[model samples]
Target: MSIQTELTEQLNRYSVDFIRFVDVSALPEEQNKGFPYAILFGIALTPEYIQEITNQPDYIQQKIKREAIHRDEFHLKERKTDRLADELADFLTQKGFTAYSQSEENLAQTGSYNEAIQQTSLPHKTIAHLAGMGWMGKHDLLVTPEYGSAVSMCTVLTDAPLETVLYSPEESMCGECQVCVDVCVPGALKGKTWNIKTSRDEIVDIAHCTTCLRCLVMCPWTQRYAQRPVAVR
Candidate 1:
């Protein structure tokens, strides 16, 4: 097998789903146009996991206080996912490519305000564009036949030349589904355009997002769907 395929296989051994290789050398010009390549490791955070966290006193207290927890505690259950991202980075470094985590802050720093605005559209759309996942819905989350939006994504950037796979972008499947938009307490979803720029323009007085995962947790699409086991190949 080729090196990239071997790498994908190795990643699969860790139960990573949807491994993709992205070539970002062209990003300077594209400027958030989309990545040339990206490795998408899918993680399904089940309702059980959510319930467990919700049951924690500290988590409940933090939620009540509307405070953000420290990263260590915030991602306590996601350590394995973070490690996967790190391991992928290390592997890419060994292969002579630079890699870094693409956090929201990182996105803001690299791209202009406009670029960041564009990113808020939908994670699944971005993933699907890279052929890492599938189409999204009005809830602004990706929907796959298997996993719904319960999947978390980690991306890997590399200079390595790898074969690309193409999947036609799926149409928006959220036909007349305004449940996500209507249920948002802070009204983050304003029907017209979900871009960050439009968001800022709509509510300049709002300081920050409510961070309420109401939109995330209340989605019928996510709750009703049966998740595909994301085992590493």
Candidate 2:
């Protein structure tokens, strides 16, 4: 079997919903040096959990294990992604390959898109798109046909000569779907379709985003499982 296939099978032992690797050598030399291939993986969030989150206040008022908690549930999932990425990086290192990993909570925020347009030092979103995991959404979030933006991403960079897939970027699936834009409480989303060249400002105004994450819940794909009536046992 190819090394890529073996690695994919190994990582599948973890709770991964998606996984892919892509060449990122075309990017700036500063953030990326010898590590050209980015190992991207994502975990799908609980549709019911996301559906319950109507806004920040809703998230804040959530009860977990019979106790009220704020953002704890969300951060818990981010930690899971980080843990798996760390393990995977270590696994690669043990095999005599150099690897570095990053997660949402453990981001290399040299800066943010809110600051300079190109300030994001290590953008996992860009890596994920290039890896063919999904397309950039008009909502300024990675949108996958299978799970929409309801998945948390983890990234790792390595220089190992592993077999990688030939990628043709996933095309935007939100054609004329203004649900995310229309439901955006703060009007952060631009309702514009996304392409490889679409800039952050063209799709989203970060300043206007309240981080309520209402747009995530508004994604049509997110509601796929939620729309079904509960099966009474």
Query: Which ten contiguous residues of candidate 2 have the minimum total lDDT?
Result: 105-114
| Predicted candidate 1 versus true structure: per-residue lDDT over 27-121, tens digit per residue | 35344344355566766667654444434524434655775444423244245655676677687778776665444444456553345345433
**Clash count of each predicted structure:** 7, 0
Clash count for candidate 2 is 0
Q: What would the TM-scores of all predictions be?
A: 0.67, 0.80
Whole-model Cα lDDT per candidate?
Answer: 0.54, 0.74
Q: Using alpha carbons, what is the TM-score of model 2?
A: 0.80
Winning model by lDDT:
2
C-alpha RMSD of candidate 2: 4.0
